[model samples]
Target: MDPRILDLFCFWLLLSSLLRLCSAISSASDHRYALGDLVPFYANKVGPFQNPSETYRYFDLPFCPPAHVTEKREDLGEILNGDRLVHAKYELNFRQDKPLQSLCKKTLSVEDVRIFRDAVRKDYYFQMYYDDLPVWGSVGEVVDSSGRVHDRRYFLYTCVHFEILYNEDRVIEIGVATNGETIDITEDKDVVVEFKYSVKWKETNKTFERRMDKYLQQSFLPQHVEIHWFSIMNSCVTVLLLTGFLTTILIRVLKNDFIKYSCDEEIADDFDESGWKYIHGDVFRFPPFKSLFCAVLGSGTQLFMLSIFIFMLAIIGVFYPYNRGALYSALVIIYVLTSGIAGYSAASFYKQMDGVYWVGNLILTGGLFCVPLFLTFCFLNTVAIGYKSTAALPFGTILMILLIWMLVTSPLLFLGGIAGRNSTADFQAPCRTNKFPREIPQLAWYRQTAPQMILAGFLPFSAIYIELYYIFASIWGHKVYTIYSILFIVFMILVISTAFVTIAFTYFQLSAEDHEWWWRSVLCGGSTGVFIFGYCFHYFFARSDMSGFMQTSFFFGYMTCVCYGFFLMLGTIGFKASLLFVRHMYQSIKCE
Candidate 1:
């Protein structure tokens, strides 16, 4: 590979990103609106990654007030930019409880006030209740006592405020209704009057209050459609770049002869019918315990990365709710990006195994990947559409999914398929297995079975369950997108750790005269996914606090993603180890 090519590739991608950002800014001017003082205010909602808005206050009106109204008026100076002077005006509306006079014959006491406040607190939208409901809550308070003293005297005044969180897809409406209606022990019909508070912009300082509403009304806002477009462009570009890189690597792999060549035919006569390698007419087998140890290590490395990448993309805003095809979009993106690891590991394994049927290898690997994914999608889609569930992908979204597969994922995958065609390195790593193998009589029962080896991989994954829960919670409950940074780091750690652990266990297995390298490597490396699987279940049943339908959907959705990731990891590391072992065995025999 040319260093300049890599440098130039990075440079081009960076430049493209910068250009996209600039384009976003250039279009911003057209969307700007003039500020006014008397504009009517609407409730603003907070969203992931966006800051809260600090403008107009919000108060919830009852269902029976006939119509809503605003009260009180205040003008906040003006900002003069060029020919325009924007003045800000505020209004507050209060209603007197004249109708409540019929129900409340006596003055209200503190105890009644407490009961009313408690009831309202539990009943009303307490924590942007609708906005963050089912997951988290917002900041706010409640009233202590209704200040109504006599028949005509109403003692409660409600202060309301709206804290705008984000401005991405839809404007979130979060209202904090606090401090109103204080009554005595009896449940009096306090006419329960509601008030409105608002602020708007104005062109002039004089009559700013009157003009404020006009300013707000005239302020033109671009529909969420534009933002969604921007996000799509950015996501498309990123996916393209990643897909392109994978394709390049895959193409190179397919072209390489040594990497593609399988040794199964050449070595067929040398092995026993039971698939055991031999030395000096004796079965050269690795102790079962050591093999399992190696598999777990390898699998762990793969799982860590798969999880991180999936979450990172989610957190980075690429798959936000505003995007119509977020789930499918994510699926395609992750699958394509994953090809690099898959190719490297799988190809590396074939080399070790001295395997035959390169074409078979390629087909098997790709099929293993695509089948599970298609099924998962089909399942999700069926449930979503048949049930009119928000979870289903729309036709347009399905097109997006196709675009991701055809334009992004398939291309990269095809390249990986090609690259995996070659099998040159003979062994994945430089290290070679020694000849005239020293036989260790010691053997463990756990190493012989596939289940036990798989279990080894499962153990370490358990250690990291706590971290996995945080990731799940963030995605499902919080609905936050954009987790790339943390994901990248986690991936690095998983890869390095798996490699290191495999190498360590391999050394031990070798010293112990355990030559059953094939399954051992996979068992050691693939175990991580098992651990992740278990932890994911634990999170679903025990750790997660999410309630209702969301809980069920989130659990299954995330589980599907994690399970796929696990299989990929197992395939990669297991394959790599097997390849490495084969090379070592052959090298030792040739030298001897």
Candidate 2:
């Protein structure tokens, strides 16, 4: 191999090693612990079971506080994930079991009663951590078995059972059970709540490396593994059928058309012009809004690559659900690093199109996705602040993100734009454009761009909708999504289906003598996003139990951003595929 290639490979290996080292250090604890060594415990967040995003600090509900109240230092990803780990009041020792002991006894005031009552009514759950392993338990519950809103007794869970599993001296897992003492705080006068806890340590043969495997194996996932496999196989079958149909139809039709055109050129003095051949002169005409289109394509290209890299990393176990904020942190860092690709793609494409406004194109490319996302984030942050939820970003976090954009992302983007503008060649079209545009004939409503887009989008959407359900459940519900390999396969299928369907629709549009397939091709491919958004609506109302303004806004707002990204990525794929198909078709025939 060349020295340059060797150098690149070495660099990649170094980076991967560093990343793995960081991950291990972040997640794992020293296996050897001396007897009576203090094991630090941390209280994380509390939230309603139904609303995953709407979390608050663990102490928000007047929970017992630690003497010093120190917070655990967290990285950017952890903060973004809404983790707020504070020192817990419980005293734990390595390999030492504590019998049922009194943690804290407090007399509840009227205000405290109200808070506890609300939390119990909402079915709040709290999370804690010991040696990097997480434990979760419910706060309280309503005493009425029938679940009647009126005349119900509010019972607070005041005791905890901690089961710690150890492999030799290494702590492997921590389990929490809240089915302990319950005290009724039905009246506000004077209710003394005594909080208690017991610790039990047991030996296990499981290695420290496999400690997190338990959290990944949720009971719900085991039961649904067959369904997940079936869904993936169904999507694979869809792709194969779609691919076969498109290949067979396009091959037979194109062959006949190619033979007919070649024969006519050989014999006829003046061959009758019809179908796609009639508008060959104007087919390569530059579309309107060149700058915006180029910017979109550029951003789409960057997103496309970013997604692939993230998925590849996930498949290789760089991050998992147990690793709090690792995936999101990777996404943010990779996106920042890849900003240059967006600028370069846009600038190069714009240059090829003979566009003069280089600076404007760069600016547009940089802002195309960031601007909308920033605005949405601001709005959501405002809502989070209003609700005093942990989802709201801190001022410092926001500043850090801005600094990253201004200092790092912007400079890389400009550098890429400069490189692209200087290095790229002029756009080469297989056929020359005519000075006068060809007149397109009117067609039936079903053949129109909108109708074609709807039809074109359905196939790709159908391929992924089933997978989308599990994804939504994982994100919005308590389900763990550990099947990245299957997800990666489905993603590939979705891309293939989108490209093939978009190309077929483009062919149909061109056969109708419509040379304005530039934007139509993109729209046809991107229409899957609209379908995805529509599915979001169905999921929100019909499937999810999510309610309240905060949850509703969060669900729809973030989903819109997701669907828009899908639109851009798939749209770019479609346009590129159709472009290739058009060029090959025109180049193979005598279009002069």
Best by lDDT: 2
Question: Cα RMSD (Å) per model?
Answer: 16.3, 4.0
lDDT tens readout by residue for model 1, 1-592: 8744553454354345333332322112222122221223322222111111111122221111123343322111000000111111222111111121121132334554443343343322311222211111222233345554332222333333333221222222222333433322234444333333322111223331121222222122123324334443443443354345434533563233223232355664454322122231222333333322322332334344555655655555444322222343334434555544444444444444455544455444544546665686677566545534334444665664455444444344445545654644553333334545545456676544465545445433433343454456545443333334444444444454444344435434543446555455655665676667666667767865444343355357647766666655654565455455445543443221
Mark the 10 consecutive residues where model 2 has the least summed lDDT.
6-15
Predicted candidate 2 versus true structure: per-residue lDDT over 1-592, tens digit per residue: 7744553454464356447534535555565677778777889999999989889999998878867789988777789989998999987788899999999888888899999888998889998888777789999878776767677998899999888888777788889888778988888777888899999989999998888789767624678879878888888888888888889757898887787666765564566668787788988998999999999888999999999988878887777555777777778877887888999999998999999998999999999999999999999999999999999989999997887777667777888999999999998887888999988899889989889889989989988888899989888898888888888988998899999988888888888999999999899989999999999999989998888899999999999999999899999999999999999888878887
Give the alpha-carbon lDDT of every model: 0.39, 0.86
lDDT of 1: 0.39
Checking candidate 2 for backbone clashes, the offending pairs are none
